[model samples]
Target chain A: MEPLLSILIGVLVAGAVYLMLARSLMRFLFGLILLSNAANLAIFVSGRMTAGAPPLVPDGMDVPPEVVANALPQALVLTAIVIGFGLFAFALILAVRAFRSLGTLNTDDMRVAEPKEKG
Target chain B: MSWYLSLPLILPFATAIICYLLRDRPSGAWVSVAGSALGLVAAIVLMALVLQNGVVAGQMGEWPAPFGITLVADLLSAVMVLITAITALAVAIYALSDVDARHGQLGYHALFQILIAGVTGAFLTGDLFNLYVWFEVMLIASFGLLVLHGGKEQIDGGVKYVALNLISTILFLTGIGLLYGQTGTLNFADLAVKVDAVENKALLTVIAMLFMVAFSVKAAAFPLFFWLPAAYHTPSFAVSAVFAGLLTKVGVYALMRTFTLVFDHDVGYTHTILLWVACFTMVTGVLGAAAQSDFRKILSFHIISQIGYMILGLAIYTPLAIVGAVFYLVHHIIVKANLFLIAGISQRLTGGSDVFKIGGLYKSSPFLAVLFLIPAFSLAGFPPLSGFWAKYIIVKASLDESLWIVAFIALAVGLMTIYSMTKIWAEAFWKDHPDGIDPKLSALPGRTALLVPVIGLALLTMVIGLMPEPFVTFAERSAAQLLDPTEYITTVLGPEAMQAADPLEVAP
Candidate 1:
């Protein structure tokens, strides 16, 4: 399970990097989403997967009686996903605003803040 | 007892909510200022408590260590929080005049307060995962503030800033996940104990490199700092000031904290890499500054360079070197933020940020020129200033190690810094305005509001410079704490955890 998930994460990261390197801002946004999901999956797999086992302890017991999936990584991943969603939404809006105001999404042309010096 | 730990975090957040509700009113800005003042009081109390108690730790919601969220303050965290509050209050007051009513209507004060809360949270958190959460908090608020006015240049800069920072954030998250897999814990103190027992030392080093890369981007080190100059000059002056003062330093703080506390097993490998990164960051940053013609752009690049000095302190990994890093951290915040505030006033007076287009500052307002000279010269590492002592200690540390090239690089960077400062002075202050306009301080609206913070911060720079004894001693104690974190670990996890983790006792 760990090996297969690691391969999937690797592929996702490769694709995301390719998309992120593109010149268009929309493509960059897509890459960010892909990359964030890859990170979430990485956290999930790294916590050591357990098959169909919930993390709840049985009643009246101090600890779980059987092997259970790790709950902490799940919590951390949930928090990361929410935070990633907020940031991705923000980046999407910012890209749109850049498209409208700057009249292009090509990163090379969006050099208003640091314009090329006159030769 | 925990109130001391929680009050600094709570005040700014409470202020942020109230300011958001009152965004449409003139009083919202005042509420932000008053809240920041209270935060300063809270930070002072926390500093006093840490000074007396050695290391103070409190678990949130009564959860025990290694399982629940923790708020801890040693000398480093205490001083960082204290300095953070000082910068916040200064910027909040400056925003009363710098942030216009239109931005106020758009909830600028709320975002600003949230940014402060995020910075405070980052300084105080004891859990690695919790630190990442605080980073996200700081990131979102900064994004809002960066593009609040939504100018073409602003959106353009925001794209780069957001895109780059998000990449770093993902890397940091991945690092945290992998690390948790190895140690089964995320608390800083717990990781410090467990990491030594990891079977695969090589894999641990790999994870350490991952953290180094992620945090280097945050600190705006070389090859990853292009986003800074791109975005910083686009924001409002007050936003730039706080971002300049606090944002990248959070990265430096994380580097200092994690490297010292958790990743000390492979210092020879990690700290060596940090040394090269520090040198390249310094030379590249100052050279970048020399090419800039704008006031704020020059200051932005200098931030990258000064970051190198702090990283250099960490890279050297000596007690005096760590002391230099801590001293540099505090002094840089006050001096750098004050420089940005001065840049704002300079822009208002001269009607532009490009140094060539605007001039006559010296002839028109010697008082403002004097104000500018204080931080600018200090930044250049002149004698009898805060930056002088900071640069002095860092240089002495490298020389003590007999790293001739590193010492030479540090000194040469200081020289290059002075060159940039002189350029700003000659171009913007001494020369006549190209358009023949006299840019006087008195002519600017809200002159008092702007000048007050500038003056207050300048006095701070002077105070630290003239009386460096207490500050040096404080840095010494903080460095000792960083090098030997036994007290910190015990305070956070209690004495039993330490004894249980002690291998010698276990063998018996």
Candidate 2:
């Protein structure tokens, strides 16, 4: 299970890097989404997937019983996912705005901020 | 139990929410100013506490360290928070006159406040995961502020900034994950102890490199600083000023904290790489600045260069060198932000920011030119200025370590910085306006709000320069604290926890 998850993360990262290198802003957005998922999975796999009960306290005790799942990585991942969602949403909107205002998505052509001039 | 640590974090957030609620009204910007003032007061109190107590730690929700979120302020963190608050107040005041009604109505003040909150949070957080969260908070708010006005140049700059920063975020998260997997702890103090016990020394170095790359991108170090010059010149002057002052320094701060406190196990490899990065960053950044003809673009490039000096201090990894880094951090924030603010005023006075297009400021507005000269010369490392002392200490430290090549680059960069400053002076202030217009300061509206902060910050640069004794002593003490993390660990994780740790894992 761990090896399979590792392979999945590796593939996702490869795909993300490829898309991110493309000139189009839309492709870059796709790359970001894929990369974020890869990060999430990497964190999940690092915690060591074990077959055990859910990370819940049996009602009436202060701490969970022994042999439960590792809860810290899950909380970290959930937070990362939510924050990543917000950032991607903002990035997508920025891409759309760039398209509308700058009239091109090509990274090379988006030179309005940095106009080339002969010295 | 120390509430002072929480005040810096809470005040900005409170300002952010209140400013957002009142975004549509004219009073929103005023609310931001008031909130920043209060935040500055809180930071001063926190700094006083840390100066007296040496190290202060507080755990949230009553959970002990290693289990709950920890807020720790050593001398480094305290001074950083204090500097953040100072820049926030300066930028907040400048925003009143610079941020027009249209931008203000679009929640500019709210986003600015939130960015401050994020920066303060980053400085105060002791947990690794919490630091990542603070980076996100700062990133989101800066993205909003960068594109708020929505011009073609702004959107173009914003896209690149967002894309590159997202990649850095992912890399940082990945590093966090791998480090946790190796050590099974996310607390900084615990990681310092546990990382030593890991049998795989090679793997630890690899993880350390991963963190270095992630943070270098944030610090705008060499080969990773393309996103900064691309975007920084496009935002409003106030936005650019705060971004110039605080954002990249957050990256540099993270590098200093982690490298000194946690990643000291393999300093030979890690610090060597940092030293090379620091040299190239200095050379490349200055060269980048010399090529630019615009006002803000040149300043933006110089930010990359100044960052190199700070990193060089860290790379040297000696007590005096770390003191130089600490001193450089505080001094650069003031001078760089003041330079940007001065650029905004010059733009308002002349109707353009391109040096070729506007001129005659020496005759028309000598006051503004004097203000510009103070920061510009200080940035170029003139005697009796803040930058001079910062450069002197770092170069002296390098010479002490027998790093002749590094010392030469440090001095040579100072000379080149002076050259760049002269180019700006000759074209922007001395030469006659190509269009034959006299750019006068009186023409700028709300001149008090704009001029006050510039004057105030310029005065600060002078004070830090003239009275270098106290500041240098503070930097020395901070450097000593950084070199020996015993006080930090004991404060955060308790005295018994330090005793229970393995001796081999303790920092040398």
Best by lDDT: 1
Per-candidate alpha-carbon RMSD to the true structure: 2.2, 2.4
Candidate 2 backbone overlaps, count: 0
Q: What is the lDDT of residue B396 in candidate 1?
A: 99
Rate residue A52 of model 1 by lDDT.
71
**Tens digit of lDDT per residue, candidate 1, span B72-159?**
9999999999999999999999999999989998999999999999999999999999999999999999999999999888898899
Q: Please provide, for model 2 over B310-381, each residue's C-alpha lDDT reduced to its tens digit, 9 standing for 90 to 100.
A: 999999999999999999999999999999999999999888999888899999999999999999999999
Q: What is the Å distance of residue B321 in model 2 from its true position?
A: 0.6
- Please list the residue runs of candidate 2 whose C-alpha ends up more than 4 Å from where it truly belongs after superposition: A59-63, A117-119, B502-508
Quote fnat for model 1: 0.74
Candidate 1: DockQ? 0.58
TM-score on alpha carbons, each prediction: 0.98, 0.98
| lDDT for each candidate structure | 0.94, 0.92
